[model samples]
Target chain A: MNMREYRLGVSHGLPVGMGYFSVSFGFGAMAVSQGLKVWEATLISLTNLTSAGQFAGLTVIVAGATILEMILTQLIINSRYALMSLALSQRMGQRIGVFPRILIAFFNTDEIFALAMARHEPLTVPYLLGLGTLPILGWTGGTLCGALAGSVLPVSIRNALGVMLYGMFIAIVVPPAKREREILAAVGLALVCSSLFAWLPVLQKVSAGISIVLCTLVSACICAAVFPVKEEAAV
Target chain B: MNILLYILAMALTTYLIRVLPLTIFRKPIRSRYLRSVLYYVPYTCLTAMTFPAILSSTTSLVSGAAALAVAVFLAYRGKSLIVVALSSSAAVLAAEAVMRLAGLL
Candidate 1:
């Protein structure tokens, strides 16, 4: 593995690390609010790298959910990683072995997946590992600090920071959405779908995890059919 | 112990989802429709997660809207994600403090 490739990966991961830090801070606060100790909150972030899955699973834990319930919730919430991994698998070099694949898969969060997939060159094992390292540290470290300081943070400040994650999401989508009419329409469709599921009585009964999956799948399929983007147009 | 088990289960389940596809699928997916769906997954999922929930994440609706507006503008202007996130959060903090002082929250 060339040092240059690994360094390149780290450089690319810097922004992702920063984003993960803030988002996991919010998760840490949420976990603390749900009655977990700081160490427990950090442990959750360490083991589960997903924001939505960790939040949803923690809610189930707070509710005294059954193990089966927890499993189902996590499976549904985290199923998107399967798609990301599948897409990334095609990008990896054919010679990559099992151990690196296993290690790379463990740290494959949404941001990492998006960043890796955007690359035009084939993804290498060392580069993938390098890319995964800082974001994992940032995620775990942020959770640790936030969990430890959860009580010290005032409620208003915590509430204010609440918008940071959503802001990051907007930052991610808006630039691309502005450049691509198809992406903009898909985003709008997904937004409308989620709002419907949230407000409609029967649909509202569905779990948040399931609602997200349903909305994403339905909107994605409809968007693909109505506005299939050309290869060059996709980024 | 039960809590530990829950964490372990979650980790295991999440890891399996990530690994299964990465290990098993060596070739690129061939289906056009499937490719399109996969292509749009990130945008759709991120959008779905962002909206509706974002409306209620802040201390007040006005604060949330204000933060979102700032975020979109900064993002459009090509500010980095970290800058956009922090600046919008700062905006919300300011809006929240003002609202609280004015008894609007």
Candidate 2:
């Protein structure tokens, strides 16, 4: 039974696992280039598949941002995972034991969520197990390989891989935004607001950490206010 | 102070972000506001992380970002993921060469 379930999990997670491998390859190489050891970079992928968090955290590490800064930055950047987990719990068909859930939570990333949601059936613990495990393993493994090849690949090649991260973000946002006018509006609103801060001198000084929180909250709030999702009375 | 301790500390702190919320919100999160918040948070975080470093990597800000933008456009227009990744990355490489030759960046 366990064997079959494990196989099932791997089947469901192949796309995510492979995608993470590519993405984290760049991340691993970058981390090493930025002076983290290969082991440290690989460990980052193992512990946190939260790409944005790691990228942001790398900045803090490079800049030697204070402990308080790291805490606050990570909290704001990663707050959405709390939401992802909430949605995931509702979808998880099997009840999760605390220890297992803790382990799974560590690797709950966008690729995994997209892969899991693409499935027809509601989630099972084994399925969630697949979603979490394979991708992270792929990520860690890719990072190791990338870190090893860091020097031979050259900086231009490395810099080019950085665009993969950007491509991923645009790929994530543009599709849904195209379909839903509201989502598109929220994105446009954020782009405008953020860009304004970009062009404006005073606002540019506002921390990126704070800017993300404010922009997301304000943009999302405005959208919600304009086009509220009606919750029918639960009879 | 040591590297192992540093890795462990950062790792623990990073884990705590995802951990604390699941612990508190053990049950289903049905809050509409919160769900809406979740939908947009990752993008904001991505932008925050990526924007600062992207421009300085090359001389011309527009070309590198534009190449990626074109790839994204093609992707949204229904190109395959591989197409998007390769073409966009190709765009960046191509653009840098052009910008350097043109001396516009």
Candidate 3:
């Protein structure tokens, strides 16, 4: 175990964990308001570690949907993770063994995946674990606090805090987009596609998860065809 | 409705979606097109999730747009994640405060 790599992973994870704390705080408050016990909300955060999927799952549970419905909802909402996982798997290569892969999979939330991918160096199991540790703690810990507190924070502060994760997303995308025309094109295409999904009457009916997946696929495919990364740079 | 069952099922479904690709696809992808798509996926996915969505994330469109503008500017200038994120949140608060002062919120 390289302590240096582990520490670097932990440092990279800190901001992500903080962002997760704020988002999951909202999730916890919403879960309690919807009648979940504090422990139950915290447990969901700990076990599932997904924002959209858990929120959608909660809706299914509250609606008294069948388990099959629950499964289907999760499958659609979290399907983007499949793509992210595939990309991350390639990024990690075979150095990450089965056991570590399984463990890392549990903490492969969107932010963690982005942070991991941003690293220029080859990934290691210890680093991945360190990257994951605080996020799990923050997510579950925030849920526990939020569920217990039950929306104690004022509306204005909550509203402001809500943008934290999106801000981080922008931070991650902008640097790379600025450096590469293909990436910029892909980001721009995704922006337009997602806007259509959000606003078009017919397309707005599509769920957020599916819409994101569709946007990603469309934008990525177009960019790939137009501007294939140089052979050596693809790695 | 069994809550434990619901949570377990939800967790399992999400876990499987995340875990399968990682464990199954250990080899490097040789296809250039596919690799390029993978290379571009993170940016596209993050951008898709950020926009339009961020515009509606805050208390009002004004505050949300303010946050987006602040985030983009800071990020374009090569700010760190924490700085960009906190600055964006601060922009939201500032925008909301202005709106409130103007009796618009």
Candidate 4:
């Protein structure tokens, strides 16, 4: 294992883990309030590792929805991960074997995926594993704490903590966008598309997951056609 | 209802969606256009998720917008991820405090 890359991954993952803690804290509190056991909530976090999909799944479970409904909901909400994984497949270095790929896929979340993609070098197994560890712990651990404590945190603190992940997202995207005109244009196009989905009466009916997928597809396609990355730079 | 069964099903479904692509597409993609799309996907996806959603993420629109402004400024100036993230959260806390003091929240 490359110790340097592992440490680098761990350091980069710290903020992601911290952000996951607050979000999963809210998730745990919500699950318990809806009558789930603390362990059960933690188990969901341990196994799922997805924010939106888990939340939606919890709603389905609480509503006594059919397993088919649960499957469909998770399939749709978490489908974007498939896209992320596809992109990530090309980024993986030769060191990432099938076993590591299987393991890494479990935690191929939005934040981690973004961080890995932003790396100029191909992804290594050690780095990916190091990155996944804290997030899994934070997610499960925070859920346990939240389920047990159930909103012991003050409202003001919780409110401030809510935007932590989005802040990280902006931080990841903005620097790259600033450096590349094509990326900047893609970001702008995505913003406009997402805004329309959020606000337009007709588009408002689209689910958040589908809206994100569509916005990303539209923006990425336009940028790719208009300004395909030079072959040398793509590698 | 078997809750564990539901959890298992949800977990399995989500995992399959993620794992299939990674395991199947081990070889590098050769298409330049496809590679370009992949390159742009992360930025576009993250951007779509952040905006509009970030505005509603906090207690009030004012605090949320404050966080966005702070985050964008710091990020544009090439701040590190941790710095930008913490500053944005701090911005939210500070904005909410000011709003509370002014009876706007």
**Candidate 1, clashing residue pairs?**
none
Predicted candidate 4 versus true structure: per-residue lDDT over A1-235, tens digit per residue: 7999888889889888987886687678667766799899999999999876786677678878788778876765576687788878877856568988999999899889888889887678888988888998999998998778765666666566656656767887899888889899999999999999999999998766567668878898999999999974653
Model 1 has a DockQ score of 0.61
DockQ result, candidate 3: 0.58
TM-score of every prediction relative to native: 0.85, 0.84, 0.76, 0.72
Residue-wise lDDT of candidate 3 within A123-205, one digit each (tens)?
A: 99889999998999998998888777765666677677667767877888899889988889999999999999999999998
Better of 1 and 4 by lDDT: 4
lDDT (10s digit) by residue, model 4, range B1-105: 999999999999999989998998666557888778877876787787788988886779999899999999999999976677678878989999999999998
Restricting to chain A, the TM-score for each candidate equals: 0.79, 0.85, 0.69, 0.68
Q: Residue B103 deviation, candidate 3, in Å?
A: 1.4
Q: Number of the top candidate by TM-score?
A: 1
- Predicted candidate 1 versus true structure: per-residue lDDT over B1-105, tens digit per residue: 478988888888888988988888666556667677767877887787777877777768888888888998999998887888788888888888888799987
For candidate 1 chain A, the 10 contiguous residues with the lowest summed lDDT are: A226-235
What ranges in model 3 sit over 4 Å off? Answer: A1-41, A50-97, A108-128, A146-150, A232-235, B1-10
lDDT of 3 at B78: 100
Q: Which scores higher on DockQ, 1 or 3?
A: 1
Q: In model 3 chain A, where is the ten-residue run with the lowest total lDDT? A: A150-159
Is 1 or 2 the stronger prediction by DockQ?
1
Q: How close is candidate 4 to the true structure, as a TM-score?
A: 0.72
lDDT of 1 by residue, A52-111 (tens): 678667756776767777787666557668777876776786778878898899989878
